[model samples]
Each structure stands twice: as C-alpha cells, then as structure tokens.
Target: MNPTRHAVSLGLRRGWTEFVLSLRSPQDQGFYLFMGVGTLAYLWFNRDTELEGTGLLLPTFALPSILGALIAFGVVIGPAYALAMEREDGTLLRHKALPHGMQGYVTGQLLYHSLGLLPLLLVILVPSFLLFDDVMSNGAAGWATVAWVLVLGLLATLPLGMIIGSVVPSVQKVGTWGMLPIITLSAISGIFFPIQAMWGWLQAVAQVFPIYWIGLGMRSAFLPDAAVTVELGDSWRTGTTVLVLAAWAVFGMLVTPRVLRRMARRQSGSQVQQAKEAALQWVR
Candidate 1:
C-alpha cells in the first residue's frame, strides 16, 4: 500500500478507537450536548417567529439542524485541538517520525469523529419527537431534511475540524475559537434569523464559507416545501453546497499534509515547552 494510504488506514483504526473514547469522554460529549440543548431551547423559545405560528413544526426542522451544526463541529474541533496539543508536546513529532505517522494522526481524528455525532443526534431527536410529535410526523419531508442535514453536516464539519485543529494552539482555544465559526456561520447560514436581511455584500461574505449553504441545505430538509425559507438564492443550492463542501474537503486533504509538514518544520523545542506549560495552565 502507498505510505499515505497505509497511514490513513492506521489513523482510521486509531481514530475509531478515539471515537469510542469520545463516547466515554465527558467534556467532549458535554460540549456537544450543551450546545445541542442550548440551540433547541433557543429555537423553542423563538419557535413561533421562525416557524411562523407553527409551534409543533419547530423540532423537526430546528433541532436536527442546530444539533447537526453544534455536534458536528464539536466532534471535529475537540479532537483536532487535542491532536495539536500533542503536536505541541512533541508527541506528534514522535508519531510523525514513525512510518506513516502523519497519515495515522490525521486519519485517527477523522474516523473517530465521523459517526461520533449519532448518539447526540438521537438525544436531540427523541425529545424533539416527544415534544413536537405532531409537527414532525406531519412533515415526512421535514424528517428527511433532518436526516440529510445531519449527514452532510458530518461530511462538512469533520474535514473542516481537521483544518482548524491542525493549527490551533490547544484544546482550550479550540473551545474558545473553534466554536466561533460554527456559531457565527450558523447565524450567517440563516439559523438564527434570515441571512436575507443582510446586504448582498455581507451575504456574499457569508456564502464564502460552507455555513450558509449547509444551513440552506438543512432548511430545505426540515421545513415543508411551503414553510421552507432559503434566504440565499442559488438555483442549484443543494448541488452547489455539496460541491463547495466537497471542494473544501479536497482542499483540506491536499493542504493538510503541507500544513503538517510546515508545522513540523517550524516547531522548535523551547516554543513547544512554553506552549505545553501554557496549555496545562489554561486547561487547569
């Protein structure tokens, strides 16, 4: 096998192990659950406005999209930060020096987080059904939308998380800064209100990233055809979003090796020590 493929396979196996760890990992899981709940509650409170008087309709559309955005980012960001910290600590160097080390390192994170959001999605989904059973059942299309968003959200967030984590200083900053894009993008993506309210120039900025398109994809999935609001108008919005995200994924794949190489080449012993001490204090 090619060294890259071999490394990815090993990383995937290790990442799978870590995925199980994430299941048992409290802080990581909490990171996801907290936002999932917060999003659900926030949307529930404003259900009427977003839903336009359809209270029961909120969960079907709202919960999954929010949870997908929240949890998917959570899943990727934490592990990436952890990996970076390890890199800072010189563990990544040790691993990287190993045959296929870099590949394994990245693959472990990707695979571990891939299906990691499933349980959390279920957690968000079931209660949503309990509370908004009528609305959810009413729109079969909505359910389909929810499922699709969750899937695409996974695809979008996982690689993006890898990109973010590759350079982030530590896990602490990951929580602080990493979550910002997802949250900010969610707003831009039309999750909070409508991105349509913004000027075209700003709207153009929002769409520069995948958040708006992903949110639009989610919007299409969850709301009925009539209730659905696709603020950013692209005739082939879904296909476009998929293409954009896939392009990013490819970009991430291509750039990650170079980024890793650059990060490795630039890192020195003292800086790493200083980084670890700072990380420990911050974590504590």
Candidate 2:
C-alpha cells in the first residue's frame, strides 16, 4: 500500500477506536443524556405554542434548527479542543516525528469528528421522533434533504475548527477563542427562534456565517413547504444556501492544509514540556 494511504487507514482505525471508547466512557454517556434530556424538556415545555403564521408547534419548528446548531457546534469545537489538547499532550509531536504523519493525523481527526456526530445526532433524534409529531415533513424526501445539508455543513465548518486548533496557543484558550464564539453564533443562528425577528443588520451578519445557513437548510428539510412563508421573503433560498456552503468548503480545502503544515513546523519538545507543566498546574 502507498505510504500516505497506509497512514490514512491507520488514522481511520484510530478514529473508530476513539468513538467506541467514548461510548463506554461514563462522562461521555452522561453528556449525551444531559443534552438529550435538556433539549427534549425545552421542546416539551413549549410543545403547545404555535408560531404566529406557520401553524406549526414549537417542537416541530425548533427540532431541525437545533439539530443544525448541534452539527455546527460539534464539528467546530470537537476538533478545536482535540487538536489543542493533542498538541499539548505530545500527540501531534509524536505524529510529526513519523513520515507522512500529518496526513494520518488529519485523517484521524476528520474520521473521529465525523463519527462523533453519529452518537450526538442519534441521542437527540431518536427520542425526538418518538416525542414529537410532524417533526419530519415530506417523509423520505425530507431525510434526503437532511443528508445533503449535513454533508455540506460538515464540509464547510470542519476546516474552520482545524484552523482554530492549529492557531490557538493552548487548550485553555479554546474556551475563549472557540467555545465563546460558537455559542454566540448559535444564539444568533436561528436555532432557538426565527431569524426573521432579528434586526436587519444582525440578520445580515448571521447570513455571512455557516451556522445560519446550516440551520436554514435543516429547517427547509423538516418543515412543510407552507412553512416557507415564515422564512425570509417567503422562500427557502435553496440556491443561496448551496452556493454559500460550497464556497466555505472550497476555502477550507484550500487553507487548512497550509495552516496545519505551518503549525506542525513549529512543534518542539520544549513547548510540549511547558504545556505539560501548565496542564499539571491546571489539574492541581
């Protein structure tokens, strides 16, 4: 087998192993439970409320949007924290010492993060379907739309996470640089409510980012065609959604490799030691 291909194969296995381990970890299990319960509770509490014009209940309106937000949140922050922590813990350094190591490392991250979404989505979606009515409109066609939106959203946003991880100084900084911004974006991305209610300028700003588009695509997938009246200009804007997400995907493909290479070039034993010391202090 080719060296690069061999490395990528190993990385794929590594990702699968990590996912299995995460499933067995009590902390991860608790996290899944907590998020699923919390989201379901919110939707349940507001289940009877109807949107002013859409005639859809709160859960039906919010479920797909929340799923989209979760997708963006998980893909972006997962790799950011992982890369930062791995960089400090000597994982990246170890890989750097091997030939074609970066290729393998990137592959592992992509696979791991992609697989990571499965449990997250399942934890929320399976129960959601049971508890909510009319949560999926258009049946199989809606599911097909969901599949494409997820694929495009992942392609557009995963690279941004990798870039953030490569650039941040330490794992500690991920909260400020990664978590904060993502949370803010989620709030403004129409996950909790319709973006139509926001100020015009805020809506414009939200449109510039992938989070809003992802949520929009997801809403289009789950909501009935009549619900489009609640969206901006009473249309789904499907063309714009595809165009914007594709642009981000192209940009990430162009930029992430160069950023990773630059970050790898700077890794040194001394920095890893300092990171270890800092981590120890944090633990204490």
Candidate 3:
C-alpha cells in the first residue's frame, strides 16, 4: 500500500480500537468525572460571579474563560501528559505489538482521552440553559459559527497536545512542566482574563498562540455584533489563533506518528540501550 493509504487506514482503525480500550480503563472514568465537575462548576458560577453585567447572554468572559480552561488544561494537556506517562512505563510497548502498532495506538489514545470533554461540554452547556436563564440569541448563524470555532479549536489544540506528548522526555516530569504551559496558555488565551487589557505588545505576543483565537471565538458565539471573522491579514479577526493551531495540527500529524514509532521501537528493544536505533528509525 502507498504511504497515504497505509497511514489513514491504520490511523482510523487504530483510533477506533484505542478509543474503545481506553474506556475500559478505570483511570479514564476518574478523568471524566474530574474534568466534568470543573466545567460544570465554572459554568454555574460564571453567570452569577463574573457575568452578572452581561445579562441574558453568556458574557464575553464566560465562554472564553470557562471553555478555554476545559479545552487547554484538561482536554489538551491531560491526554498529552497521560500518553507521555504511558509511554514511559512500558505500556506503549504492548501497544506497539498490536496491529497497526503505535500510530493507531497514539491516535486512539488521544481520541479516547478527549472523550472526557464530551460530558464536560454537556455539563457546562446544560447549566447555561438552566441556571443562566439565557441563550446566545445568535440564532443559527451564531450557533454555526460557534460550532466551527469549537471544532477548529479542537483541531488546533489537539496537534499541540500530541506534539507535547511526543517531545516531552518523561511522563514523570509532565506534571511539573506540563502544568505550566497549560496554565500559562490558559491565561494568555484570555480564558480566565481579558487579553485586551494587556499592553499592545503583550496582546501581540498572545496572538502568537492559539488561546487568543479560541477565546475570541467563544466570546463571539454569545456577543452580538462582536465583528468576529477569520482572515489571514494583519487584522485581529483573521483567526490567527485558529490558523496557528491548524499549523500545529499539521505539525502534529507529521511528528506524532514518527515519535510514537520511535518510542515504540525503543520500548520494544529496551529504550535506554537501543535509543539510537529507535530514533534513527523514527527520522526515516
């Protein structure tokens, strides 16, 4: 088979299998519960505490702040770090023995881990309807825009997560180091705070990251006449964050499989002793 066909068939088949097996793992359950509670708590308190002024719609602060945290901190970093750990403990070796080996295994692992976000999304959405007593009022256009934003956000952040998973040297250090990126990205993305308040250069710096666009998209979903549009020019509305994220996704698409394969081979052949052989294979 050609390389393209081989990768796709393997990736799809692997994603499905990994997704299923992941659900059976007890740790997956706890992950969902913890993330779900966080999303719910943020949505519930958001209206009363931070968004009381907006009235009848999700405030600019709510979606970006809340969803940003849910997406970046938990959905993005959690799986990436978890996968990193699994690779270290020799669990990934067992995966490499399976059909389609590490590529499918890692892809599936990401999708499987991201499943926690589904319930978390629902948890946050429900409270917005019940407690906030408000709707986006953006109608079909608004909802469609929001969905695309969310999808783009997912696609963009996912690759970065994979890259982080692949590049990070050890799972043990993921918490110590990984959490910093998650938290810092969350802040810069303007998920928990306003980026516009920062200096122009700081805002420019924030623009270099994905959190900014993701937060803007979330805010646009609720804010009427927010002038949110995607362009590639110097305009702030050019969806730079989403585009950067898409680039990362492409980067992830290329890098993650190679990294997984290398790790898998190292795992199979004894990583420390066979590191050079595995790394060479990965580059090829």
Global lDDT of each candidate = 0.65, 0.92, 0.62
Residue 210's lDDT within candidate 2 is 95
Error of 3 at 99 (Å): 5.3
TM-score of 2: 0.97
Arrange candidates by lDDT, descending: 2, 1, 3
**Candidate 1 lDDT, tens digit per residue, 112-184?**
6666666666666676666564444337766676666556656666666766666776656776667776666
Give the lDDT of residue 99 in candidate 2. 89
Measured on C-alpha atoms, candidate 1 has an lDDT of 0.65
Using Cα atoms with residue i matched to residue i, what is each candidate's TM-score against the true structure?
A: 0.79, 0.97, 0.75
RMSD of 1: 3.6
* Top lDDT hit: 2
Give candidate 2 misplaced runs (Cα > 4 Å). none
The worst-scoring run of ten residues by lDDT in candidate 2 lies at 10-19
Please write out the lDDT profile of model 2 over residues 1-284, one tens digit for every residue. 79989999988888888888989999988988888898899999999999887789999999999999989999999999999999998999999999888898899899889888888899899999999899999889899999999999999999999999999999989999999999998998888989988999989889999999999999999999999988888888999999999999999999999999999999989999999999899899
The best candidate by TM-score is 2
What's the lDDT for residue 144 in model 2? 94
Candidate closer to the true structure by TM-score (higher is better), 1 or 2: 2
What's the distance in Å from true for residue 34, model 3? 3.8
